[model samples]
Target: MLATLDEQAQAFREDVLAGLSAPIPAVPARWLYDRRGSELFDDITRLPAYYPTRTETGLLNEVMPDIAARIPRGAAVVEFGAGSQTKTPILLRAIAPAAYVPVDISGDYLNDSAAELQASFPGLEVLPVVADFVRSFNLPEGIDSLPKLGFFPGSTIGNFVPRSGTDLLRHFRALLGTGALLLIGMDRVKPIERLLAAYDDPAGVTAEFNLNLLERINRELDGDIPLDAFRHEARWNDILSRIEMHLVASRDVEFSVAGRHFRFSAGSSIHTENSHKYGPRGARLMLLAGGWTPIAEWTDPNDDFAVILAEAQPNRFAP
Candidate 1:
């Protein structure tokens, strides 16, 4: 179930306060999805340097037939972070699942997207649940009767740190249960130039997307952030094999969020997001540790991205 508007606002206030209070200040990337942020991200995906979205979409187009074959017909398809549901129709048309459950943090956006999808694909049962798929939640009514297939595409898993990533995979394993299937998209390790370009596009769409977080803070949490005081910065962390996104202070500035004030030095930055890249072997190992066994994986021609299908393994610890 979705949290009430007040509850959601309170949680947002608490998270922003806590993150800004940290030794190295940081905010959760999930907070970057207010209406404006979401729209900015959609623009970011279309930028020439943003390869992940296009590459993943192409790979999905190529592999959906095979993926659909593996997914049992009449099964319940539950998708995490189903923004736009753009590539989803490929799988839906191929598999013809009994029902579609899309879980996203933005309730309003989810409803609009779900309504459009339902209209586009008449007769497919569309059940939209607004929640953070990273955490736990109950599946809607009638879902238990059908076999469950979890769809977590778009490499959103890359957002989490390693331990959290494993925990998220395990959470999906538990939710889907033994023998259930999971189809996921992961960005693969690539050259630093390519990785940096993907996040820091030349057209500045990505920069706008990153800076909009502050705008969201200002609008939603009654923040006094000066939007132009900070600039977007993206760097490839070779050691971590991830692209990190930050909002660096262009000049020394002070801001207040939810009545709590904070200061930043000229060179200081607030970390906003991390996009981890993975090799097939590394991804498989991570899935194995999370009680999932790899089934089939496909990659684009340049080896820039991958779509993996894995099955939930029996949980020995289950009572």
Candidate 2:
């Protein structure tokens, strides 16, 4: 069994304490993918204002055939952050891979999705790997002969800065080995109003999603933090070409953790996440930087989002 919250996990918690207890509070977005946070994210995606999930799904439905065509027959498909495996069926129907691997940091949920998928596609093999694909990812050692296709269907790539995104893509390519195919979803830059609307939905679910990150910390770390002490704030950073999410302090306060006290000035904020919006040019540049060469791209009818197919470098696989 995979160790959950082991030594690395303990160190990660300590780092979170240090960052949050700083003169300014900052929490890494990585911590937000825990079970509670994962459920909150599912709720967030269902909100009317959150458009990435729906938009990306629509585009994928429109282009699954092309995605499948790019892959050779009887390929092995692996997905990262395979939530509910909801958006994957679109690709599965077209590609019908020899094996399906779904990897995610959420162990229970990943297994649940894998079980359901196994029932749905009995003929196809299903292997579920429980680990954070962001940190360090190593695929199975065998299967060198199967066509390895990486499917990152959601706009999850937007969570990383451009440089980090490049590194992540390179890591994914390296894991897949040479002659592998990648299907990635990317959110496009749109009107500022639209971008703002998607994050700050009318139902307030998005707000809860942002603040829940704090609650998640308090719950997991034995930290005493009044959830009301922090408020959710989302802003468009035009200069950075990204949407920044922060947990703003409601009042000047001092929080203690790891035997150390950290103070936050009222009105100051802890940066939690940044969602980068990319155009076609930016997307292609990012893929290239990550060492994956783009082979095909499909955009929404209105060109609101894009799903690009990139190939791992012929020799970049981790041998």
Most accurate candidate by lDDT? 1
Clash counts per candidate, in order, are 0, 0
Candidate 2 clash pair list: none
**Alpha-carbon TM-score of each model against the true structure:** 0.96, 0.93
The lowest-lDDT stretch of 10 consecutive residues in candidate 2 is 1-10
Please, what is the whole-model Cα lDDT of each candidate in the order they appear?
0.86, 0.79
**Candidate 2 per-residue lDDT over residues 19-113, each given as its tens digit:** 77667566667767777677778888787778888888877777777777778888888898864556888788788888888888767667777
- Model 1 lDDT tens row, 184-206: 89999988888888898888888
Score candidate 1 by TM-score against the native.
0.96
In model 1, state the lDDT of residue 19: 88
Query: How far out, in Å, is residue 20 in model 1?
Result: 0.7
Q: Best TM-score goes to which candidate?
A: 1
